[model samples]
Structures are given as C-alpha cells and as structure tokens.
Target: MATWAQFAAAEPELAVYGRELLREEQGYAFLATVSPGGAPRVHPVVPFVADGTLLVSIAVNSPKTRDLRAEPRYMLHATVGDNDTEFAVRGCAREIFDDTGTKWLRAHRELNVIDIPLETVLFALEIDRVDAAIWDDGPPHRQTWRAPNG
Candidate 1:
C-alpha cells in the first residue's frame, strides 16, 4: 500500500491549497468511499471545522453514507483558485450520531430541517495526508505528509 505521504507527494497543487485553507476557515470537501460491492461513491459535503476536526453530515439512505457505514475508509478532495490548486486527503472515516451529532445536524436549519432524517451520522476524516498539484503556474509543486501537521 502506498503511504499517505507518498500519495500526497504525487500531487503538489493539492498540498498547497490544503496548507492554506485548512486554517480556521470554512470550506467544502468531496468525499469518496467504497461501497460493499467495491464500487465507489462520491458526494459533495459541507464541512464544519471545530478543534481541527472536519465534520461532514451524511444521511442514512445516501449512497456515500452507506459506503462509509460499510467501510470506514475515505478520500477527500477540495480545490480553489480558478482550479489552479487541488487539495486531497486519504484516511479512515468515523461516524458520530449522538447528542453532539444532533447539534451539528441542526446547525443549518435551512438545509438540515428537511423531512429527510436529521439524525444522520457525522463522518469525519482527520486528513491522514495531504497533497497539492498546481497547474497553469510556473512549475508543478509538491509536498507530502505522514499526517496533517497543519
């Protein structure tokens, strides 16, 4: 298996953006998780940052949610700057659906108050490694991490 650091090293534009936006800011992340049958499911997730934890909500019936529930592995990607930079991470997913989970679920009333189950679990990945790959710039840049040292 490729180490998370090695994986990130292959893509630098992603690393640069991750280093920049991951600090006390709010942004969205795209999640990819494997289904029980080995197929991949991708979903756009609105994330919350608190104490360095990136929390994402998933409904029980959603494909991505089912994927994470069956397999606790995931990959996340985010980009900025007219697509000049890309940030990605690979790690394990954890579920949170208790008291605190309710608070997070209710944080956005406009979106979370829908008839869909509000008690959906929270899937969080602690960014095991980050990578960046820059295009349309001078030269491609890169960096790897054993864990998110940000």
Candidate 2:
C-alpha cells in the first residue's frame, strides 16, 4: 500500500484531480465497508489528508467503525458532479494512534461542532489502488494506479 504522498508522486495529475474531487467545498466521499453479513455498507464521510495519510473518523460505536475494525478492506468513492466523472480509491483502512492522527483529530474537533472528531475512532486508508476518468470533449480518459506491492 502507498501513502497519499506516494500516490501523488506516482500519478501527479490523477492525484491532484482525486484531491480536488475529495476536498470540494461540500467535501464528501462514500465509504464502503463490509457489513457483518458480508454485504457492502456505504455511508457518506468527510475524508481528509494529514501528513500524506488519508484519515476518516466515525462515531466510536458506529457500525462502520466496528466494520473497519473487523475488516479493513474498503472502497472510498469521491463525489463527482454531473459530469459522471468517476474517481475512487480502494484500500485497507487500519486503525491509527499517532501524533499525526491525534493532531488532525484535534483540529477537526476545534473546527467542527461535532464531537466525533474528538471522541470517535479514526483510521488511515492506505492506498492500494486509484481510478479516475476524465472527459475532455471526446471520449473519457481513464487512469489508474496500483501500489508497488498492491
């Protein structure tokens, strides 16, 4: 798996577009995890980058949190407007507890009215693969990247 910075370094343009799609003004993404029944459970999320790490926080006892702890595999889809442009990331989200993680979590709590940033569980989604499609007058352009070991 690769870190966000590494992905950017490998695919500068694709990474830039991915970041733009993820951090839009209405910043949102859909996090897909496996439910206890082995089905996909997707929920909207506010995903952010910290020191090249992709971190997302959820309510401590939320089903998604439990799902992640139990099975880290996930597919995170960035919100694309009417263009039908597809941008997505697939990876294993591992629980994190480091200074970088804490700093972001704290800042998040200070910036938002919600308590989840301060009290929720956080995980870093290491990039296993990235996919994007771009449209420019003609047929859409597709791009993809896989971690060196992924």
Stretches of candidate 2 off by over 4 Å are: 110-116
Candidate 1 Cα RMSD (Å): 6.3
The digit string of per-residue lDDT tens for model 2 on 1-150 reads 999999999999888788888873645799999998899999998888877888899888899999998899999998884577878999999898777777888876676554554777789999999989888788999888999989
Q: Roughly what TM-score does model 1 have, to 2 decimal places?
A: 0.68
Residues 1-150 of candidate 1: C-alpha lDDT, one tens digit per residue: 233234336545444356465332335567888989998878877655433456677777888878887898888776353446666777877887567657655664444423435756676665666566666657756655555343
Report the CA-based lDDT of candidate 1 relative to the real structure. Answer: 0.62
Query: Which regions of candidate 1 are displaced past 4 Å?
Result: 1-28, 108-117, 148-150
TM-score of each: 0.68, 0.91
The per-prediction CA RMSD against the true structure, in angstroms, equals: 6.3, 1.8
TM-score quality measure for candidate 2: 0.91
